[model samples]
Target: MRWNNATTGRWTHRLIPNLTPWLQRRHGQVDFYLTQMISGHGCFKEYLHRFKHEPNPYCDHCGTGSIEDAEHALFICPLFVRYRAEAETTTVCNLTADNVMSCTLESQSKWDAIANMAAGILKELRRRERSRRIQS
Candidate 1:
């Protein structure tokens, strides 16, 4: 079942090619940040827009007009560049959406650092989402 689903198709499935290992080795409980990052379901504009909850998919914080998908927000958005830098500095791993699952399984420190980064970014995004709702 695990090998059969390891297709280069869905974003989550691609990142997590082998589900058994990840499920067996994941440290700590899966939190809000991990859930959002892994599942690509959250307050992200791209997700909201896809589900008809948001008017557009563009990131409001970056002003780059890029789709606020999990990959763009976690890996490319300039708004979280500082967070990325700090996480990378601490983990010594170049963070990417594709590698986050593997990196988390590598060590406890890496997991904690990545989790911190994700939590910070998502919390800020959630705040912005609420602000956007109030403004609109």
Candidate 2:
């Protein structure tokens, strides 16, 4: 299966083991936030540092000296704890890198809840990134 064999898009694969349901059910554009969360190729510090846009991959908000990869931003960042908690409560599922796909695919409401939460967090991250750039 392409799901297990692909080197990239592991995050996406984790959430969408079979594309049929997602393709058939999914509506509207994927949006900037969800694309970055799945592809790990957007404004994330780890991705930016990898591309030499950032000096370091560490999360400026968490203070734990952890790399600010998509997984960290999605699941572990205290900066977005409220958004994460709200999504969990709304979806009735514990969010995890491995389980996000399943949880989101559970229902239309679950999908909307997760997508909104992700958008909120990523948009804030993008805003913070832009502010840092302007200050520097």
Candidate 3:
């Protein structure tokens, strides 16, 4: 099957097969982060705080010490535990940055599965954020 389209506006038919070996590096991780728009950092909190909107950097749902960073949203949050479990089922992965990045550099099939899981988590995150906005 095809990969890296519908994920992007245009199809990248020739890029999928060869992208693996490159994704193991820092630059590759950044590329993946940018493409996913979830940097596993405090990007979401910073955006809200930049607008004077979020008030505190602590998570809205988890009440954790850290902000609602992408990692927290995707992996640490109890709210998305079910979704994370679903993602785990795809690879049964331990959910580490190193693991994910290495996986991306290994197999196209695994990478596609990871991409889909990440996209699904982000979709749910967006839904929650939108709902919060509406409620506010």
Q: Root-mean-square deviation of each candidate, in angstroms?
A: 2.4, 2.2, 9.3
C-alpha lDDT values of all predictions: 0.83, 0.81, 0.56
TM-score of 3: 0.63
- Alpha carbon lDDT at 21, candidate 1: 77
In angstroms, the error of model 3 at 66 is 3.3
Best by TM-score: 1
Total backbone collisions for each predicted model: 0, 1, 0
Error of 3 at 95 (Å): 1.2
Judge candidate 1 against the unseen true structure and give its global Cα lDDT, from 0 to 1: 0.83
Clashing pairs in 3: none
User: Which 10 consecutive residues of model 1 have the lowest summed lDDT?
Assistant: 1-10
Q: What does candidate 1 score in Cα RMSD to the true structure?
A: 2.4
Candidate 2 wrongly placed segments (more than 4 Å) = 5-7, 24-29
Task: Report the lDDT of model 1 for residue 100.
Answer: 78
Cα lDDT tens digits for candidate 1, 1-136: 4444444348788678787878799575678888888777877899999888889899876765688888888889988899899899988989887787788888888888888988988988899889888999
Judge candidate 3 against the unseen true structure and give its global Cα lDDT, from 0 to 1: 0.56
- Looking at candidate 2, the ten consecutive residues that score lowest on lDDT are 1-10
Give the TM-score of each candidate: 0.88, 0.85, 0.63
TM-score of 2: 0.85
